[model samples]
Target: MCVLGYCAGRYRCPNCGRSYKNKVNLGRHMRWECNKSPAYFCHACDYKTCRKDHLKVHLISNRHLKNVAGKIRYPCLHCGKSYTMKNNLRRHQRVECGKEKSLVCYVCDRRYYYKQELDTHVKLKHNISAKIEGFPVPMHWKF
Candidate 1:
């Protein structure tokens, strides 16, 4: 698919199929983002991110200021639900926090927070084949 706003590709990420114009940019993406779990976390909040710079921004943002007096708790600014582990809070925010699920199953009208979850639900629960139904399976889910 198109990446960086153009489709005439020179390089592509094997994990995510994002195209790039050069190997250096693709290599950088692989090293930093592609298929990589978040490596940086904010000690003050439930904020976690793949890049150190994002964690830095989160720390500087007003969200980090909500840390409870002395206890090591991470509270969601959107929902006020707390988590002890930064990763847990991050997951909660990404998967089930106050934000609406934008991805919906066409067959069942069920909603999901992530594309992978919605794709899986469409595949297994609906018994629809991606090849036959023209459902676009996520690149990471391809066998």
Candidate 2:
């Protein structure tokens, strides 16, 4: 009932109801460390950490960015490759998935899985701008 005052066994913090083995640590935890107000806030989301470096790492990491973006981005139909950016997706297709390069462009020697990609290539390479229908990446994409 009275942990703020010294008990029979160990040092206890009444405010948080935590027991410390030593009295010095109890004083320190109550003053600075134990569940203090967040000093660092994440810009991308509502995640907050006690340290500034943690926030920096969370912002720069790929998994955190994807989670913040709600994982809504391009996914390769063939190799099931996922990308948060369109350019990254394009790069993955051109360089990574060599086997899925089946969709060929008659005008130039290029291959892609989706017609939209081929259309984009045609517009950029052959100067033929065609408004092709967008292909939605599957929401149930596996990791």
Candidate 3:
């Protein structure tokens, strides 16, 4: 048979005398007529993969996959707190590092390491109305 305007070349069935131009069609006939398994196998990791693209994806993903088989250990530098991932440690450092003491507030002239603390300072000290997520906070209230 012709596929995409190209002849697939003549292929003969080993079990029968039928001749087909397409190798895939011949293989389909063999699967229905004689029942044969595909012989392709992955060389690396000895994993049974159906296609070459699947094997490539497996090899690429295996490099970045975390090794969870062993015990996980991560130590925080600022306050001796430990975590599982370096990202969590970085996030903790951003909030509680205390090395950089000055923090500018967008809503007011006050500065704080924590935004909520700055919001409290703006409300109590400056007597300004501050709204957080649609909730209004009075200047005299401490929250």
User: Evaluated with lDDT, which candidate comes out highest?
Assistant: 1
Which portions of model 1 miss their true places by more than 4 Å?
A: 1-73, 94-96, 131-133, 136-143
Q: Which candidate is the best by TM-score?
A: 1
For model 2, the stretches where C-alpha displacement exceeds 4 angstroms are: 1-32, 72-143
Residue 97 lDDT in candidate 2 = 81
Using TM-score as the yardstick, the better of models 1 and 2 is 1
The lDDT values for all models are 0.72, 0.69, 0.55
Clashing pairs in 1: none
Reference-based lDDT, residue 102, model 2:
58
Model 3 error, position 34 (Å): 74
Q: Which should have the higher lDDT, number 2 or number 3? A: 2
Off by over 4 Å in 3: 1-75, 81-90, 104-111, 131-143
lDDT of 1 by residue, 1-109 (tens): 6654446657867679887878888888888988888889777567777888777557544456455344466767777677767899899988788767877777778
Best-first order by TM-score: 1, 2, 3
Compute the lDDT of residue 63 as modeled in candidate 2: 60
What is the lDDT for 142 in model 1?
21
Candidate 3 lDDT tens digits, 48-142: 44445555454434231223224353545446665667787687687666565455544564556666777677778767646757755435332
Choose 1 or 2, whichever is better by lDDT: 1
Candidates in order, TM-scores: namely 0.36, 0.29, 0.25
